[model samples]
Target: MNKLTPPTRLTGWGRATASGASVLPVSRGNIADAVVGAPERGALVRGLGRSYGDAAQNAGGLILRLAGLAGDAVLDTVQHTVTVGAGVSIDDLLRVTVPQGYFVPVTPGTRFVTIGGAIASDIHGKNHHGEGSFGNHVRRISLLLADGTTLEISPSQHTELFWATIGGMGLTGAIVDATISMLPIETSRCIVDTTRAHDLEHILTLMEEGDDRYRYSVAWIDLMAKGRHLGRSVLTRGDHATVEQLTGSATSSPRHYDPRVVASVPPVVPVSLINNLSVRAFNEFWFRKAPLYRTDEIHSLAGFFHPLDMVGSWNRIYGPRGFVQYQFLVPFGQEDALRHIVERFAASGAASFLAVLKRFGAGNAAPLSFPAPGWTLALDIPASFSGLGEILHELDHTVLDAGGRHYLAKDSHTTPQAISRGYPRLAEWQDVRNRSDPTGVWRSDLGRRLGLIA
Candidate 1:
């Protein structure tokens, strides 16, 4: 008789954990054969589990991790496409693609993410201002269904399933392989520019003006700013640096250089490290250290896209209890209301380490997908704050009244009423999902908590 091993917990960027009902690795041929024909009542596909929320957790059912599936991660430079197993990491993608002068069309702040997780979250990037999102560049995806059937889907073929699966967070089916377009760049460097905004107005003005001009655009918000200067930020914009721009710098070819990496996280980082005094000082240093304005031609891809990727296990900095990621979007016309939420955070005395602001264009084709034409903000806070959920719940109502919505990725506290008002397309998206997953083989805590499906 052989001893049995439990399935491992699926975790990505945010450091949280859940137990699997049972653990099974996908590569084992014995397991693959057994899984496909089960007609599962609740099965979910998980890749890197990099999603900021519980979209990847199946609660009490099957959590199919797509990474272990045996296959080659083949990239076709001629067609500017790559076919990777669902488990392929973005860090690996750069190793192979950067040398070939191509890059993933969209990437989040970290590179530990898997291909399946990226598709599951339909992750966006600094280029979202110009590229829309990662899903927009996907040409096709191959899904292994619950009943041993495989289908190749795209925008034109199996369009409903295609759209649903884009941001479906693996609920639709298991993604085995996907063909996506790659962006051609002059070099692996970005022409970096930073302009410190005195307040929220300055931040939005710059974003509204030049965000369209850059392939990568992001703003860092100093959430602790109070009084009339609340929500102050520094806007950074960039595009692939040209050879001519890098001429005067230390490195001629940015591609030939290596970046300094944080190979490991500190064994322990106290929650007090991110407190108001510390974050306030850090923000002040960031604001003052930045020049009024300057252009840097030499920037590495890792530094530009996944600065934190180099720091492995940085999430532990939030301490043992883990943390919560709050991502919300406010419509263009409701800028004042958005400011109100930021102001409320100031009054609440919460310390959020990472706060990001991005301006989104037209929403993507995924009905259940998060991005729309609005300004989106993301924040990471220690989960220990007893009043945190209550404050967030109030912000949820504020967001809804402002005609805005929260991102399903970084959400955990939003209520059902807010979810309904925030996402008007929920019913239609639900109908389509119910039709596809008639057996409800796919369900996550985010879905049930938000009343996405009964």
Candidate 2:
């Protein structure tokens, strides 16, 4: 039995009477017990619910919360690497690495995600044009399989499993530890240069024309901007600052927390995120504030790498119905198809608060890895979108036609046929998963949705 057991009640994610998620709150000590005795053929591994969709949701299956497993990040400046436990958070690692003048090779838009979350997502960063997804920099991974033994995996060792795990969305196994490269930074501050584009065409031109010049760059696309300004965006680029560049915050990792003093004002408050008027207002301001194709210099890595982390419970702004982040990739060869999608959204007025467009350079050997050489777009829409499923279904068709795929980490609405059509390597991924996780002991809403398990 492994002396294991599940929790009695769920906590933090949702406080609704109709929430079907019956996750009992398990402690760190008893976490192992949660999945230890799962004789069932299927199970799901979950970390923080930070994953935007059903990627972390298992309607009725065992969920091993890796975040509750352990949190440790040992940085080796000499080796330019960090060996970390799966539970460590990006924020936690940043707090330690900045003093040593190193940073994560890849990071999502926010710092609240755990290292395990990053691995599952195989998150890319602003520099994805220059760098690839995080998986590229991973030197190795230690996976705890359902059979309960840890496998040291890399491109050369257990090659199939390694790639499958990179963007497998935790369907492969429970990642226990990982060794990843830490980028060298002269200073924690960034010399940011901001520019705005009035339309989608300009945004693509800006990225293709000068993306390689900076270490990192990202744009905020105004989904609500219509007509002449459709796909309007503000592009921000930056490189790590040098000692001479820092004005007064000479400390390596400068922070951006003007709203934190009042942080305690709403401290300990559980904020709801799904609402209408609020999102409408937020989207407008976010779009109107940027310069129309101009530039500006900025500071602070916190704001540069993760602007959303500034507010503690920013997710609460989404309200009760919650939200879903739709992130998908469209290869260079499929620009027309991708453009059609954007055009469709523009026509329908699918207002989104956050819309990011990036160009990814290469992909992992992982049979199911999300990124391929392509242009990926991410948008946050209310889960309450009446036609969400239909819209996403349509997008899935577009992604497949473009020879691109969806990141399982941000996916909850994709279909099996779409996945099969999108990833030509899906069969190999299944073989690897079956070899490592026979009996389909790992299952999730995402898995069930896409029929990862028969």
**Which candidate number would show the highest lDDT if scored against the true structure?**
1
RMSD of 1: 2.8
- Deviation of model 2 at 436, angstroms: 1.3
| Per-model TM values vs. the true structure | 0.92, 0.88
Each prediction's whole-model lDDT (CA): 0.75, 0.72
- Where in model 2 is the C-alpha error above 4 Å? 2-36, 39-41, 67-71, 249-281, 292-296
Clash tally, candidates in order:
2, 12
Error (Å) of candidate 2 at residue 177 is 1.1
Which 10-residue window of candidate 1 scores lowest in summed lDDT? 1-10
Show model 1 residue runs off by greater than 4 Å.
Answer: 1-13, 16-19, 28-34, 37-41, 68-71, 248-254, 257-260, 266-272
